[model samples]
Target: MSTYKKYFAAMALIWAGCAVVIILAYLLLFAPQSRRRLQTENQLKETKRAYRAGLKAGQKDAQDLAREQIQQMQHGLANFVTDAESSANLIFDLSQIANARQLDSFTIKAKDDREKSEMSDYKNIGENHIDVSFTGDFNQFATFLNAMERHQPVIFVDQFKITRPKRQGTANNVNMSLAVFVRKNNES
Candidate 1:
């Protein structure tokens, strides 16, 4: 070959070697850095998506909790009104029971039966039971018992007794004692 051709070939070889060295340096150093940058970008996107989903779930839970509280308040108010109406109805029913039973003379005695101590026989809670006494016929007493049971208000007849009048000489009248449970006046 000629001398000029040999010089041209050497120049080409030097240029090619420089290009290979540069490419190898980039592969060893910058390539790993670029891969790490891509991984970081993907992680950031996943985190943003997760945050949005968590926020939506939190909002749904708050709404469900608020609705539950409102329902509980409404139920409590309804119960209060029902209790007040029941108390008023109980009073009227008791008066009606007295009239319908055809009692000759009835007395309602309220006494608290809670025992404070065995020695003193004093009540602690001080709630009262009802004692209804009258002088009436057997049929009238039975009718009173039936009416008491049929009444709208709740009434528990705890004890009752029918006995002939114990006096000088009174045979037409009989003594009747009825013990019943009445709701306390202070009850809600």
Candidate 2:
């Protein structure tokens, strides 16, 4: 071949080799990198969707748990009150407790119910007061108080007056007022 043709052929060969290298670099490096980046982006989007769904489900579970707890509390509160029959039963129970404690005397009388204010959360709630009188030793009185606390229908000691007898052998006299919450039978 002539010198100019040989130089032209060498240049053409070099150009073709450079083009091949460029194509190989794109296929080996850039193409795989772009594919991996696309895969990572899709995984990230899927993870975010799953996280949001889990968050929504968790919120719903929390709300349900709170509602269930409130219902349980309401039911527990319902057990703290006594109806008319239960009130009579409670008086009898108190008498029994006093007898068990060996008190000198014991009496229980129910008073009128106290109405709650309209603005109160317990609007239909009423207080049933019970006047209790007992004569006993200090130990017996303490036992009586403890028994009252552990009794059903949840009695609350409103007020009390204690008087010691003039004679040492005589028992101490105690007058106490107790109260318990009850649902009103008739709503106004």
Candidate 3:
């Protein structure tokens, strides 16, 4: 009976040592793996948050740039409208201009730059020349030219011709023809 009791006690001590070893092995292996998994999860969450913040900031910058461009275009359009209105009101008083010139038959010819040999050079040119023919004395023709020169907006006269009446019945009248050029002020 004494020998059996000693064997039973030895077996119990071995079982208890095996149980302790198993517990230590599980803790050493699995604890490190679980801790590493938790750290990885936290890192993934931080990365997602940073990406979201950056995306939001990028969207805001795009919106601001679009708004700034729209405002600039609007300002440019307003300035263009003001300038167009000013230019449209710049036509001279034709009746008064004609009376000052002693003009009988006044005809205006407007040729666009599209007809120019160098089309690009005259694209912005808005100029017209008035071809005037009148039966008047030399003094009246000279006074008309003088008046045109003294006008606020300058008129350029290029071609001039005066002829005595070819027929006997129209001896008192002189046939005169002249070209007067006027420019539209688009800068206003």
- Which of the numbered candidates is closest to the native, going by highest lDDT? 2
Report model 2's TM-score to 2 decimal places.
0.58
Pairwise TM-score winner, candidates 2 and 3: 2
Residue-wise C-alpha lDDT for candidate 2, range 34-68, written one tens digit per residue: 99999999999999999987787579786788789
For residues 42-86, could you state the per-residue lDDT of candidate 1 as single tens digits? 999999999987786579786788789999986754432234335
lDDT of each: 0.62, 0.82, 0.57
- The TM-score of predicted model 1 comes to 0.38
Q: What lDDT tens digits, residue by residue, belong to model 3 across residues 100-142? A: 6656654443333323432234434343434455666666777
lDDT of 1: 0.62
Error of 3 at 107 (Å): 5.2
Candidate 3 local distance difference test against the native = 0.57
Alpha-carbon shift of residue 55 in model 1 (angstroms)? 24
The predictions' CA RMSDs to the true structure, in order, are 20.2, 14.4, 24.0
Model 2 regions more than 4 Å off: 1-67, 113-122
lDDT of 1 at 72: 99
Worst 10 residues of 2 by lDDT: 112-121
